[model samples]
Target: MKTVEQLLQAKGHKVISIAPEKSVFDAMQSMAEYNTGALLVMRDDELVGILTERDFSRKSYLLNKPVKDIQVKEIMTRHVAYVGLNDTNENCMALITELRIRHLPVIDKDKVIGILSIGDLVKDVISEHQFVIEQLERYIYDTPEI
Candidate 1:
């Protein structure tokens, strides 16, 4: 039953963000430099929206828009789903699955604390399952004359 706070602490809470007024090209450049799939859209220290590769592909590329000229605020997803630090990983997973979203921002009193991705949740779940399986195998095979 690991908490989001614990996961954040383990993974580091730093998140890459960009201003809403920045160009889509700038967002892409920042994403490339950070090697991240998404960027938090911020305005005056407030989380405004989120820009992801999917947004670019679907909105800009498919629509034949100029990425260099378009602003991030134009294509970013403004309606975001978020979790808090005290929330359980289970809640995070549920929100991701229910919303069909890949990333979720962790908030604390209107402040962005961290970000979580589907990959991160999957990795953590797999690791925990592996540990449980190993423990079960050890108990079943290593018990002495029970």
Candidate 2:
């Protein structure tokens, strides 16, 4: 039952965004530098879209479009699915699965706060399950013979 706030607190809330007018090449470079799979496309602090590696592969490589010539807005997903700080990891996972998207932008009062990746949600769920299993094992072993 971890919240997006918990995840952001565990992993500092740092959002990497690029201007919509920027070239795809620039967005790719930023993704590399951040070691992230996606980057938020912003225009004057507004969440316009999201540019991801998949977009690059599908639009740039497969289509043989030059990254330098194409803008992020050209390939980014305009209708982005988002989560809020109070949202649960389960909710995030469900949205990601339903949308078949790997990233979700976290917003607060119409302002972009953080970005959550499928990887992040998976990692959190795994860790929570592990903790619960360990607790169960300890309880079972510590119980007296009946």
Candidate 3:
């Protein structure tokens, strides 16, 4: 089974984060520039929360705050979910499904390594399945009078 560390290595451990004191507007701009759906909320190099499009829509509605008036610290999800480097891809998929969350931070010894999305897991699973199918086909073709 593939591990989260393998996935991070394959995908590159690049994380884009924003300060907690930043405005929601700033978070959205960073998300746009990075072409990502979420950003890790950082407070002095420590991850404090996560900001996503869902947070913007739901939190704004509940808080009745304008986008410009809102800060990421106000709207970002404070109880962030995370995964570990040693976790299996299947485990991460299950966690995302159970949590109904799109993004999960990857951490090791309290150090942030990377982030994984539902999309990332899906792509990796599909690619792995494709590779297995190809290998099986090659085995059957190469076998003689099995």
Candidate 4:
């Protein structure tokens, strides 16, 4: 089981964040620039909430509120689901599945370290499975055939 620490190391721990007071347009632009689906809504280094594409589509666009007119705090998801650096990839996958969320902030000792997306979890699982399959094949070929 690979820990989030390893995952972050492989994926690079670059957390794209935006201030809670920032305009929705700003958050969206940051998301675009980062090529991410969500952004950590921070307030003076504290993880206040998460602003996601769903929040934008559902809250702002649907409400017909212009991005410049609204703030991230208004549309950001307040109840965030988070993970720790020591957490296993399986645990992260389970949490994301059960919570039905795309992104989770990775924390270590109350400090925000990185963020994990559903895409990241899926990629990790696929890589792990591929490695296991290759190992099994090597072992089978190295042994006598039945």
Q: Which parts of model 3 have CA positions greater than 4 angstroms off?
A: none
* Candidate 1 to native Cα RMSD, angstroms: 1.3
Per-residue lDDT of candidate 3, residues 1-146 (tens digit): 68999999998889999998888888899989999999999887699999999998788777776777788898889999899999999999999999999999999999899999999999999999999999999999999983
lDDT (0-100) at residue 59 of candidate 3? 83
Which ranges of candidate 4 are over 4 A from the true structure? Answer: none
C-alpha lDDT (0 to 100) for residue 93 of candidate 1: 93
lDDT of 2 by residue, 1-146 (tens): 89999999997779999999899999989999989999999998899999999988887765566789888888888999999999999999999999899999999999998898999999999999999999999999999998
Q: How much does candidate 1 score in TM-score?
A: 0.94
Please provide, for model 1 over 88-134, each residue's C-alpha lDDT reduced to its tens digit, 9 standing for 90 to 100: 88998999999888999999998998999988888889989999999
TM-score of each: 0.94, 0.94, 0.94, 0.94
TM-score of 4: 0.94
Cα lDDT of model 4 by residue, 1-146, tens digit:
89999999999989899999899999888888878899999887789999999989888876577789898998899989999988999999999989999998999988899999999999999999999999999998899867
